[model samples]
Target: MEYEKLVRGDVELWKRKLMKRSSLLNRTAKKAQTKMNGLIPEKANSVITESIKKMVQGALFGSEYLTKTKAVRAATLEELDKEVKEKLNFYKKAAAVEGAGTGGAGILLGLADFPLLLSIKMKYLFEVAALYGYDTKQYEERLFILYVFQLAFSSDQTRMETMDKIDHWETYKEDAEEIDWRVFQQEYRDYLDLVKLLQLVPGIGAIVGAYANYNLMDQLGETALNAYRLRWFNERENGQKQEKQSGL
Candidate 1:
């Protein structure tokens, strides 16, 4: 019970933080991103579109990661969290390095960073989901993982809508046709607008790229952790409800 309370406390803190109103900087960034999206070229849009499609496909349907790794045996949430954090830290450092290398390599490599970073992020989520005792091989679980990604990168407006979707994922996912990948790609691209563009600049790109990827991975890790917790809590409550009904 003590452990559960502590876990709930932490989750509540994160939920509150996520719900905080957008700051001036965040609003400004969103507006700037809206303008930039309109000005971006067809080639740039295509690259982003294609990269995200590949990412979603690999995460949802690819067998490579599932084949290579076993589902983590269920343990207490505390134990699971420790393992998840270790994996998150490992990937966080790796992604930062990848960003820096590409950022320093000029236009070609900077552009290459998009798909590379997407792969890194997706891989980390797969591991985190497995660590939390969810089977990454399940299509529904993978779709949940994608929602976690969107939650981390979406605008304030979209974030609220996505939060509701995640909160009722078990019920909502049953009837949902499929995620609107176009909206996912747009929200993600818009979220990264300035920071990603800065990564293309010649002199300062390395620093920007490294910093951006580091934080990006960090945010994803945190979001995934909380998302799994939300699922666990829901299952826990449902179990309790079933036990009560059975006793009656």
Candidate 2:
């Protein structure tokens, strides 16, 4: 009887120890995850994207100041043009660097839609972050992100509803294949915004951004082929008051 009692006591003690250990482990994991998340560029990304969304929305709705300040408006328009041009150059160079054939360049030429694509990229990034439990100011950003994520994860039958009628998921898949995960990791580490948010979690933000960038281009052509991407881009900018009211 004594032996049985002693055995029972031992079992109880073991159970207590296990409970304590489990509690400690959970605490440690939570702390680590928080620390890691702190390293992501989420804050800066959020701030910059929110600002961009606001600007775009204002331009769309015809803000009084924007209309009144001809110089500011002109500068803003010039900036937009410059951005489109820069993105065009980047796409051309990126395609060249990636060794995309004449066919790829042709597609890009047909799709020369940076105004649309930029707006989409900005809004999509904001939205995807929201879906992943990130916060976004512009509701449109949220919608854009959903579109991209849906496209990214979708099976063929469902995609046609949101994006352009072009069938480029397979092409996106190909471009995604060319990503150097190692280089991406390094670049992710180097990204200042991510460095701040995901300080402990290292490469998560980079992986997300790289994958998004590569895949965004997968379905759309470079500026040479598809200028219609502008509609998608400018749509996000069309709702400034809505963007502000929605926290964007």
Error of 1 at 8 (Å): 0.4
Top candidate (TM-score): 1
lDDT of each: 0.84, 0.35
Q: Encode model 1's per-residue lDDT on 1-248: one tens digit a residue.
A: 68878988888898777777689999887888778777989888888777788877865555434434467745788788888889889999999999999999999999889878888888888887777767876778778888899999988888888888887887888976667777799999888877989999999999999999999999999999898888888888988999999999
TM-score of each: 0.90, 0.23
Residues 54-160, candidate 2: write the lDDT tens digits.
54454333322222212121123233344444544454344332322221343342233223334443433332232223234434433333344333322222333
- Pairs in clash, predicted candidate 1: none
Whole-model alpha-carbon lDDT for candidate 2: 0.35
Report the Cα lDDT for candidate 1.
Answer: 0.84
> How close to the true structure is residue 137 of candidate 1, measured as C-alpha lDDT?
67
